[model samples]
Target: MTAKPLIGITTYLTRARWGAWDLKAALLPASYPAQVQRAGGLAVMLPPDEPGAAEAVVSRLDGLVLGGGEDLDPALYGQAPHARAGAPVPERDRWETALLSAALERGVPVLGICRGMQVMNVQAGGTLCQHVPDLVGHDGHNPAPGTFTDHAVEPVPGTLTGKLLPDAFGVATHHHQSVDRLGEGLVASAYAEDGTVEALERPGGGFVLGVQWHPEAREDLRLTEALVRAAVEGPF
Candidate 1:
């Protein structure tokens, strides 16, 4: 029997306590693994590590899934902290950014989710708003923290996400920040009613797409299936 495609899902290494001198550790959402497996790919947890760690993991995996998590350390892009910068996890940022670069170079199919989506943007020379409400001059996309709310996103017709998801869909959101400045190679493919960049992709890359929503958290597996299919069958 043929082995399932080895898909690497990036993780966030975080310290449980939000204090100085506390030991940091790795933490990945369980939904990611379940979703990937449900979509027919073998999911492997790839923890954030040194510069070379990404390349090592990419070499073994046919696909990459950048998982969701905390706000990134703004210093990665030479920026000062915003009021909503929260706790800076330099180690995690360094690890995932390096891994993302490596995965891109290796031409691995990539699906970035939430913080993963933001990392993809930063890796391609982009910046974030830190907090959408503060920058957008409003509060709707992210209403309450740690809760799921639906937001409207208009998808670009004929794009991967468009073909996979509904033409105009309500996606679950729980992010404080949103994509402010776009990156080098990505094209903003979808947007919220308030004009937040809800989805992005690189046509030049094999299958590089990022969405600022939690698709795995939902039971409907179409999104995950489409991603896995794209990786296994190549972007069409």
Candidate 2:
């Protein structure tokens, strides 16, 4: 049988509770691995590691998924912390940033979601709006704590996101930060009705795409499938 592409997904190192045990754990939503499997890939959970470890990790993976989590430290992109911003996970920030750098160097396909999207932007020397509601004038992008809201995003006609989801499509969103300055070599590929950037991509990069929504949270596998397909097909 043909081997399935190995896809590595970043996870949260947090204090999680399960069956009367509350301890530090490396965790990811079950939806992520399930979605990867459904998309015909082997899913592997990648927790935060030492500074330079990402190079070795990326070298073996066919693709990478920067999964969603806490807000990035504003200092990463040269800004003060906003009152509305969540506390930063320094280790995760450092590890993931290194992972992104190595992945880019190796030409590995990447799919970044929610906080993942913000990480990509910040890694590319771009800035985030911190509190998106402050700019969009509403909390629709993040309607509640730990709950997702539905919103439509219009993908640019000729971009990767647009080609996969050609029209306005509803997505599960729960984020307070949005991309402000476009990242180096990154272009906005989709936006919400409020003009908030919903997706970004590097046109010349091999399958590097970031969406400010949670595709794994729902049954829609189009986005995840696209990543797996890119991994299976190798670099463009």
Candidate whose lDDT is highest = 2
lDDT of 1 by residue, 30-54 (tens): 8889999999999998876777666
Cα RMSD, each candidate: 3.0, 0.9
Candidate 1 TM-score versus the reference? 0.91
Pull out the clashing pairs in model 1.
none
lDDT for each of the candidates? Answer: 0.83, 0.93
Position 11, candidate 2: lDDT: 97
Would you list the clashing residue pairs of candidate 2? none
TM-score of each: 0.91, 0.98
